[model samples]
Structures are given as C-alpha cells and as structure tokens.
Target chain A: MNEMIRSLENKPGLSTVGGIDCDLHPASPATKTLLPYLEEYWRETFVMRGVDRLSLAMTSSPSRAPINVRSDWKAESGFAGDTLEAVRTQALDPFGTRLAICNVLHGSMIMHSDDMAAALCGAVNEWLAREWLDREPRLRGSIIVSAQNSDLAVAEIEKRAADHRFVQVLILAQNDEPLGRRRYWPIYEAAARNKLPLCIHAGGSNRHAPTATGWPSYFVESYVAQASIFESQLLSLVAEGVFHKVPDLKVVFAESGFTWLPSFFWRADKTWRGVRAETPWLTEQPSDIVKRHVRFTLHPVDAPDQDALARTLEHIDCDDILLFSTDYPHAQFDGLNALPAAFGETLAKKILIDNPLATYPRIAADFQKEVAK
Target chain B: MNQAVLEKEKNAEAKLGIVDCDIHPAFGTPNELAKFLPQRWRDHLADYGQRSANPLVGTLPYPRMTPGNGMRRDAWPPNGGPPASDLAYLQEQLLDPLGIEYGILQPLAAGSSTLNQDLGAAMCAAVNDWQLDKWTGPEPRLKASISVAQEDAAAAIAEIEARIGDRSFVQIAIPPRTIEPAGRRRYWPIYEAAEHYDMPIGMHSAAFGWHTNSGAGWLNFYIEEHYAFSHSLQSVVTSMVFEGVFERFPKLKLIVVEGGFAWAAPLMWRLDKQWERMRSEVPHVKRPPSEYIRENVWFTTQPIEEPENNRHLLDTLRWVGADRLMFSTDYPHWDFDDPRYAFKVPLSPTERQQIFRENAKQVYRLP
Candidate 1:
C-alpha cells in the first residue's frame, strides 16, 4: 500500500529541541509476534482458539480511511505505525523530538475474556518495553491496562510503574461506563500513586454506537462525532468526582483536538452552576479544574483555518493546557506542517517543551538530569 | 385615532426587538391536549397515560441543566401551571417586555415523537390545535409550527396539508433526534409537504426518547446529555446534505431552532473537505455539501457558543453568513439568549437587522 505520508527527507522548520511529543501511536504487533512475551498457557490458548491474529483497529479510524493512513505513509504489507524506523524518520528525527510518548491502542484491552485481556496487556507492555523503549532512548510508552478487570489493571500498572520508560497509563475515551465511576477508581489510584498521567486517547471499545443515536452511516459522521465523546468523558470525569477523588491525577487527551475546549468549558461551568448540589464534590468550575489537570495534544488541530485556530487558543485562556504531538503516521496533517500555523515561538516552546515537562514529572526529571550532566 | 395615529404606533413598535424564533408554549395540563383527541384515545391516554420509552414516568430520563428541567426559573407561570403555559404571562413577561415583533412557538409536548404512530399523530394534531387556539389565535405576535409525529410521514403530511393555507403557521417542527436521520427517503414526504407549502422545516432540540443522545450509549449526566443536543443537530444536517434531501427538494428551507449556529461553519467546512474526496459515493449530491447548506439552511442563535472574546463569535457568524442567522430567545429555557446582550460582539445596524429580523422575515415570509 503506497501511502501518502510525505517522507521527512529534510528537517522540519519547527524547533523541537528537548520537546516532548505527547502522542505518537505505535501499531500493535501481531499476536504471533507477542507470543514470546506471553505466558505459555496464553500462547497455547491462542493457538487452540485459532486466534492467530487480532486487529483492534477502531472503526473511527478505519485503516482504509484516507485520513487514517496517508497514501504516502502506507506500508507495503504491515500496519503503518508498527515499526520504530517509521516514527524516527517520519516523526521524531524530522521534528527533533527529545521524547515521544507511545500510546499503543491495540486489541488487548478489548479481548472478550478478562484473563485474556490481562495476559495480552502484559505481553503488549513487555513487547513495548523491550522493542520500542530499549531500541530508542528517545521513546517512552503508556502502560496499557485491561480496564475490563480493575484488579488486573492495577497489577499491570504496578508492574510497569517500576520501569521509568512508562510515562502514563493508557485508556480509551469511550468506555462501557463513564471512566470516573467508582469501579474504575482503583486504576486511577494506581496511576496517581505511580505518578503516571492517565492518557485517554480517541478510540473506544465499540460497545455502543459512536453517536447518541444508533450507528452513523458514514465514516465522516463517526470521525466528527469523536469530539462529543471526548466532551462526555470530560464531563463524566468532573461530574463523577474523579478529580476530587484522585487530586494528583493528570489527564492527557491525545489526538483529542483542542478547538472545542473553550465552548465545553463554558457549558460545563454553566451546568455546574445549575447542578452544583447534585455533585457536592466539585469545588471549582470545570474550566479551572480542566486547566489545572487536563492537557491535550495539538494534532488534527480541529480549527482548519489559521485565524480560527488563533482565536481558539486565545479562548482556551490557559497557556499550559496544550502539549505538542506529531500524531505520527496518522494522516491528520500533511507533511512537515504537522504543527498548526498558530504555534509561534513562545506557544511552540511551551507546547513542545515546557507544558509537557510540567504535565509529566518523569520527562521533566529526566530532562533535568540531562541538563545537570 | 385614525389612519395617521395607527401608522405612527406601528412605526414606534417596529423599533422594538427582532424576531424571536424559539419560544416554547406549553399546555397547562394533559387536559389541554385531551380536548382535541378522540374519546377512545383520550381514555387510552387516561388509562395508560403517555407511555414514554424513557424509564422515568413523569419526567425526562435525565434532569436538565436548569432547576425545572432546563426551563428558566422565572418562566414558570405566575398562575398554577407549567412554565410557558400562561398566555397572558407570555405576552406580558416575554413578548411584551422583550418587545418581540414575532415569536415562533415550539411546543415540546411529551408525545411529540411517541412510538404509537397513530396516537403520536393524534397527540401532534392536538398540540397544533392547542397552539393556535390557546396562543397564536389570541396573540397576533405569536406564530405556530405544524407539530408532527415524523415517524409517520403520511400522517405528518396530512397534518401539514391541513394547516398549509394558514398564514399563522410559518414552519413544520420535526424532532431533531428522530428514529432515523431526518434525511432518509422514508421521511422525504414530510420534506416534500414542507416544500409544497413553501415552509421551512424547523428542527428544535427535544428528546425523542427513542434512543440515547449519542450513538455510543446513554449519557449519565444532563450536562453531558445537553452537549449531545448540538451533536444530534450536526448529524441531522450531515444526513440531510449527504442523503440528498436538499437535492431532492432544492427549494426546501431548513430553520434549525434552539441549536447554536457557531458549529455550522466548521461542520460545513469538514463536510466540504470530505465531499471533495468522496463525491463519487454520493453522485446525486449535485453540488458541494456547503453550497446546499448556504442556499437552503438558516440557523437560530440561542445558546450561542460564547468564546471568551466577542470577536470569535463575530467571525463564526461571518463564516456561516449573517444572512443565515435568525435571532432566537429560547424564551423560557435556562440558557435563553436575550436579544439585547446575547451577542457579545459589536454588530453593524444592518448585521443586527439581518440576524434579528430580516433573515427570519425572508425565511418565514412574514408580513
């Protein structure tokens, strides 16, 4: 598949020195590729069940969608983001990324059985640690957890927390219930304790229709509708007292565009004003809480026009809310123009370096160590 | 007080407020609708009551953002009735005080999108009759929308045809969150009827209760659910454009009441981007989706997306075209937009006149 990902033959103009790319999706390795990492029991079960391969590709980003894989970026035979070489050439090296957080959205968490999900999650982490993190010191990974089982999810986080390479815990924006429900609080507790920011990327388990109504007819409807899901999850996080419960938890919304933030903040605050009594735990306005706790990747910069993009940023008000990302191998923007035009010198430095450092302590600590040396 | 005095009085009133495109007129009680239904269905109503798909019996599945299910706290009738029920209160408190020249009534009754098709039609007919007789007939400033159970196209058309000649009826109100996207051919008869009558379809945000607000699943909070309202409208707009509703009925006009207009610009841009790449899939769509949008659709400006700066709002208005925006108060809702201070942006007199009055006047063909 001759994909249209313009090769990064020349260095991009953006100054990305010591910049932390918040979101770079790595393709899930084939199940057979991960057999060595998995326990023998799980390996035997995979063969017995005839589950040789698994593709947890979300419908929202159908691999065939032009937006999903640019014609130039398409691999000849494998998934586009599978190899680290692609990330190095197309994303990290060109942009001069110091550290790029890898969020591996794979079929592991969506597995039917809880035990299988836990097993696959563990194997995926091991594979991520040994293959990607070890291969490139510039790369760090998100700890994938089987949100299907909270106990196992906590254990997985505990196991990965020891490795400083894991910067955050990965979850999808669309879960069976609101992610803030008490049932999922255990995972949050572990994430906070481990000092891993909870990263909820824009893909769901597909348990329900992507819209409030039933299924959407077109890919565009589903794609556009992702913004609403992000809003819902954000509200759920606030309204359900997730922030109140886990005060230390920081959230990174990768590929969750930031243009809608200002509007959402107003509406959420309005709702909070009216329904304050229902959720007594919410002490501050949603906008204030989101600004303090939430950070978003600057990919698929929803504002297509430069002027509107500038206005959206102005409306966002808080300077620290945006983290930089190339959204590697995904065809959100064309070529070296992965950075939206509005990211001038000051905003660019903050988004690419300062903001990420402030949000992720591990990266900041590592950068400090490098500076001292 | 002859012709000269009357002319002076009219000129004075014309300077008041712009057209209020989103006013909700509620029935004081179930008895209001019962009067118009046949005796048998009336008994059915009394026996079974309005069997909503939502589990909540007397109220909506989720509580609204406002104290009284998203209705304005002050909007509750001074007399013992639901908010927006008293005609005199509406006149004095809203229409008179706001200086509204024409107030479009959007009746969001329990059975507007009822599952029982025939019963739904009957309920809608009752709503229409009640709106005219109780509100529009008395207050000349108030206008009626031919409410319909859109799931049943033939009945909806019949209802539209029944009120087609009445000048008081300006538009056809369809549930925004319908069982199917509003553009399916199954619902084309209603659009055809709207075009035949030269009436624009009015899509206001009301719960159909047929499905959850999102394609995913039920929303847990009213705030989250409220956000889905705009998403629902966007989906309907996309459905209408891509499904060729505009192409099929080119002259058809669409007035999306209550749903904010800020999203229209970006949504259309996204559609045009996609259509450019995927035009072959929908060959019937003769023009770019945005072209159809600009020519056929107008949006109401209540629950306006207030970015921190007023300039952003103005830029959005410009993108969607000032001619495409109609001023709406959402008179009785908690998030109602007051015409005086609703738009934070500074507007030229012409821009104000077009958005507040002229756009709606042209769309509704109001005298």
Candidate 2:
C-alpha cells in the first residue's frame, strides 16, 4: 500500500475525503431483503444493467417517476454500518485515504404514495444517526429526496440540517424542468439554510440518462448523451438564480467528467453575456456563479486523454473549482485507485484531500487535525 | 525462423508484436456482397450492414431499428477509395507498418450483417477466400479466422471442410450474439469440424441483430448496445456451461474477442454463486463456472486500462493466467490501441513475450 501510494506521489498525511457508490438495496426494516422477485423478474436486465429502480425490467412495474418526498422517514435497514465497512474494505479503505461518499438509494423514485419522500428522509436520517454522526466522523452521506415532492423535501432538509453526517442532498437529474428551473428553488433554499450541497446524479436503479429518449449502447455513447444533462442542469440552476437566492448552497455535479467542467463554465458565461437579457435578475454571468459554487468529480476519465481535463480547466477559468472523485463500484465506475493512478500523487492529493477540504471547510479542518495527529 | 539473429538486434522491432483479435472483413458493400451471397439472404444483410441502426429510437411512430432493417454499410473496405485490390500494399503498409506477424480475418456478416447464422456459413466461405487470395494469402504473416454458419450444422461443417486445408486459417470465428450456445449439441458438428481442422473458436460481438433483423429493440441507444456484446458472450457461455459444451468437446476452446477482461472475474463469481442454488438449471456440469472458464475459456485484451500498475495488470493476467489470454490490437476500430504499449506495462520480459506472441501462437496453434 505504501509503495503504491509512493508511486502515486504520497504527499504525506492522511486526509479524510473520497467517495464510492455502494451496491446495497434498501431493505424493508420489517423483513428480509430477499428480493424474491429478483430472479423471476428481468434476471437478464439485472445482470446486464444494474438498473431496476423503475423495474423497467419487470413489465408489471410502473412507468412514471414522481419527484416524491418523504413525510416521516424513520425505519432502519440495520445494514448501514456493514455497507460502509464493505465500501471501505472492498473500495475506499483499499485505495482512498480515509472516508468515502456513500451514494445510497432513497427507495426507488422521487415521489411516493404515503408521504413516500418523508419516509426516505427519515430513513436517511436514521442511517446517519446509527452509522455516522460522531461515531464515524469520516463518514459523509447524501440526503436523498425526490423532485416530485419538493415541499416535503424541504421539510426533510429542515428537519435534519443540524446533522453533519447528511452532507449533501442527492436527486436524480432527469426531471420535468431542465435542472435550472424555479421549481427547484424551495429545495435549494432549504439546502442553503442547512449547509448542504446539492448533487444531481445520473440514473441507476431510477432513470438517469433515460433522457428525452432512452439509454445508449456503449459507455462512450451513454456518457456523450449525459454531457448535455450537465450543461443544461448548470444552465437551469444559474439561469433561475437558485445560486443567487441560496447564496451558501453548493452544487456538486458528482460523477460527471470534470474535464468538461471548465469548458461548460466558459461556454455558459459566453452565452449568458449575449442572452442574459432573457432573465435580467443576475448580477454576473452564468460562468462566474457556477465557478464559485460548482464542484465536479471524475469517474469515466479518458485514460488516453489526461491532459485534456487540466487544459479544459484553464480554458474555463476555474481549476480551483475542480474536485477529484472516484465514482466507485457502479457498472461504469473506476476503482478508488483510479484517481491516484490517473492524476499521479500531487494532483491525487489535491483532488482527494485538499480540494474537498477546501469545499467543505469544516470537514477539511477536522480532517487536517486528524492527519496532524 | 532464426531467433538468434533477431534477438541480437533489439532495434529491429517486431511492430511491437501486434495480434489483432477483432479484425473485420467487409460483409457487403452497397454494391458488391449482394453479388456473392444467394439473393435470398442478401437483402436482409444489406439492410443491417447500413449505419448502426436508425438513430430515431422507440416504439412510437418512428420505424423501430429491426436487424437488417436498413442498408447496412461496411465501415471497413473504406468506401471505395482504394479497393483492398492492392494486395501487396496491404502486406507492406498494413503488415510491415504495424510489424504485425499475423492478422486473423474474421467473418463480418453473421446472418446478413453480423448475426444471420443461415448465411453464417456462406459469408465465412466468401470472407476466407477473399482474405486468402486478396489479403493475407500473399502476405504470409496475415492469418485468418475461418467464419462458419452454425445455424445449420451440416452447411457450417462443409464450409470448414472446404477451407481446412489452408494454413492461412488459424481459428474459426463466430458472432457472440447467437441465442444458441456455441457448445450446443447441434453445434457439435461444427465443433468436431473445428477439432478435425485443429482450430479454436473465436467469437466477436455484433449488435443483437446478427441473429435476425428483429434484434432486441433495446431501450438503450447505440452506447449501451455496443457493449451489450459482452452480455451476449455471457449468454453464450451460460448456454455452453449448462448444455455440457465443454465436457463433450474437451479440445474445443472459446476465445471471447473485443470484450475486455475487467468484467470476466465478476461474471465468473456471479455464475458460480448463482449455479450453487440453480444447479438444477445445469445438472450436467460437475465443477464451478470459474473452473470451466479457466479450463476452456480465455479472453483477449484490447483497450486494457484497468488496474493502474503493471503489477495489477500481471495479477489479473495471472488470475486468468498469461497462457489463456493472447493480446490483440483491435486495429482500425475506434478502440485501436498501441501494441508497443503492452510491453511498456510493468510486467517482466517473459510475461511480455507470452502476451505478445508466444501465447497467441500456441492458443490459436498458429505457425
């Protein structure tokens, strides 16, 4: 491990920052997570595509995705601790320095039948309470909510803002509004008030790149399809002045390639100058706001093209805004070591430890203190 | 033939010993393949060999992408600029430039495009003949994978019999998209024919359409569909494992072309785990899925970028072992990788030799 780290330019001291997506299904606290329908259902779909959120594999499964929010999320699956440990052993502990971002599934869709959004909120809070908070200072998890039920989602954030364990609010990005709409304001307001970053992830169990159409054939094709999602989402958020309203709220474009982050900023800023009159509320160009607020994580790094990412940052005028990530364990994700391997030790140190520390200063200060000891 | 002379001169590089695994031969040009194929199967193939399915996807008003539904165009045969007619130039530029010792020409069209198995036999005959007289036959270093149509066992076997005499042929290639296992009892005739010819079976992926023009109307666009070939291989392996394909034909070997090695370990574990409870599904198998893969199956590496260090690459190589895998360039595809880079990997000189040349020669039993 030391030798590997050395090759990765071991820049001394342990820093608590990193994240990987885990494969744990949300088990009902009342009984076993047998997945009795797992085999009988779209067994082929399960193996090929780890997506079954909408149960598209199961024709019997419903079609619509509601932006649902839980009213009373409270039950615990009793598996959070084990799941974290596995993420560590199988992924984080092996490669990353200290802790990992645990991207969990909040039931399947955004909306629910019975305060479904609230149930997920309470469940997320319970998991944090049992597994993270104080017990594991290094642990950071996303507070999952639905786009369908924004009001209830705000309520859930208000309820749990004091808990540091719930670090970010995660919502699947395929929604009715192009990501930057006023409809997302209430949720942004709540998140800013609570000191939480908002993360928009692509589809997995739920619809991610379901897009205006459907999934693509190759990883390249799928990634290309999502390039627009990031741009459009950024444009929507900035255009609607969600950032201006929720000044303190951080927007993390997690798991998308950071190589394009810089370009998106430049292009948005360029477009806003010519088109800012369409919405005259903003004090600055779209690029300036996003560069100040947006952070990106690297997953599908184009191995042959490493320098391109760094170059893009220079072009977009925001190298400091960039954050390194290893979207671990999913079908298209790389292992934790990928960050270190791809960017050598110096950049890896900055990407893994320093940049994240800078973004969430409280977490960084605590981490720096830990490494000092 | 003299290793002593070649060894003394290191600069006399062997174009880094590139062994192309997923090389394609033109199945149909908009103008020509129709000429060679029986009129019955030609139209269907012509539809698929067009652009990789229509872009406007869905079950709505748009015409769904059926296999062979469009005028399928061969990406190779580079659109009439130069007929692969300059055979000697192929040997000099393609062979000498890459320092490629051997190129295995696999059949491009399965049914009509990549999967129609009825024409799987005839397409194989046409490609093999073209590859020999036109491409590799003159360029001795260019070997070929004999394509076979196993939709009908008898016809596939006859195609093999006709070409078995050619030394230029190395392995028999098939599309991984077929619903039937490569080891099905029905395919035994082709397998036996391969063994008689001392050939291994090499499989490459086609869009699921190779089986029929009505390939699975994927909810996924081309992005997901392109890699779906790996799943097809898994289906092929599952079929083979369950139906006693390996046990019945001990000498037969299956080489998964184009699919990367990262997914293989996980697939083996999943198969073994599922088989534990689902043993009733394949009672014919005695050992675990991993064992069968270790014994009879091997995968080729192209855009191999997993496991950062040379040690990681070697560990994966050792897990699957250096012998089972033989490296290939996947030349002319969007994924074409540098063969020289394989040596740059932190592996020892011996591991390098095995991956580059020795192992391939032995696996395909090439001269």
For this target, which candidate reaches the highest DockQ against the unseen true structure? 1
The candidate that achieves the highest TM-score relative to the unseen native structure? 1
- TM-score of the second chain in candidate 1: 0.94
lDDT of 1: 0.79
Q: What is the DockQ of each candidate?
A: 0.32, 0.02
**Tens-digit per-residue lDDT, A1-373, candidate 1:** 0121122112233666667888887776777888899999999988788765656555655665666566577788635776889878877887778899998877787776889889998998999999999999999999998676899999999988999989999987776776766788999999999899999888777786666555666666566667777877788788788889899999888877777776687567765776777677788988998998899988766654666667667777888999988777776666667665566788988998899999898888898998899
Question: What are the root-mean-square deviations of the candidates from the true structure over C-alphas?
Answer: 4.9, 13.2
Give candidate 1 regions above 4 Å deviation.
A1-13, B1-17, B64-70, B269-290, B307-312
* CAPRI grade, predicted model 2: incorrect
Task: Write the residue-wise lDDT of candidate 2 on B221-241 in tens digits.
Answer: 222233334445555665566
Q: How well is each residue in B258-277 modelled by candidate 1, as lDDT tens digits?
A: 77877776576556655654
Residue B359, model 1: Cα distance from true site in angstroms: 1.2
Worst 10 residues of 2 chain B by lDDT: B212-221
